[model samples]
Target: MNRKNGITVCIIAIIAVVLIYAQSGISFGDPVYQDMDQYFLLNGQVQTGGNNICTDVVFDFRAFDTLGEATVLFTAVMGVIVIFRRLMKGEEYEAE
Candidate 1:
């Protein structure tokens, strides 16, 4: 077989192995760790003083994580704009 076909076969084999391993190791409806979930459910409202548990977790428990995600998203958008702006600089546009 050619190099490209060999590479494709290797990739497909890797993906199939990963899928089989994941399916065998993970249970669909049941989860292994419940201690953290129980703790959050019991004390999330008292600690964060938020009526919504989801918001409390996101804003209070994982504030830094959320901020980091937002910063990453903003940086990506700015990078895209800069790249496109540079590419479009040579193009001519009609007056609107």
Candidate 2:
């Protein structure tokens, strides 16, 4: 194969590997017993230290996790900006 074909194959292979890895997720089996109220109080009130379970889960117990997720979004936005700048080169727009 020619050099162009080789580079194309390499790029395709890299993309396939990335997609495969990105789609993989954790799978937890069903629990033997279910207790809704107890589970809610334990995970929500005790762990999160908040009066409201829902609020605790979202802001208190998962505050650090939310921050981490925001960082990932920020990183993705920066990556897109970098890629766009490279693709546009001298033709990039300038804001006043």
Candidate 3:
């Protein structure tokens, strides 16, 4: 095989091995990490001012995660807008 084909095959084999090892550690259809869930369910309302457990967990306990997701989304949107901005700003065509 050519160098490129050999390299591609090696890379794919490596990725497959890594994925197999990673999947072996996870217990699908089973609650492996229930302590955190139990703690949140028991204390979410008490720790947060909101009486609603779901709201408290999302808005208070996991607010930083939500904020990070929002920030990433905003950044991606801004990047797309920036890339397409020149066309909208009357720079779609120019005379040589």
TM-score of each: 0.64, 0.42, 0.55
Off by over 4 Å in 2: 1-39, 42-55, 93-96
Best-performing candidate as measured by TM-score: 1
Error of 2 at 80 (Å): 0.4
Q: Model 2 over residues 10-93: C-alpha lDDT tens digits?
A: 999999999888766534565436686567777776666778887776677568988898899999998997778767767855
**lDDT of all predictions:** 0.87, 0.77, 0.84
Tens digits of per-residue lDDT for model 3, 57-78: 7778889988998899999998
User: Candidate 2 or 3, higher lDDT?
Assistant: 3
- Ranking of candidates on lDDT, top first: 1, 3, 2
Question: Where does candidate 1 stray beyond 4 Å?
Answer: 1-3, 87-96
Candidate 3 has what TM-score?
A: 0.55
Superposition TM-score, candidate 1 onto the true structure = 0.64
Clashing pairs in 1: none
What is the C-alpha local distance difference test score of candidate 2? 0.77
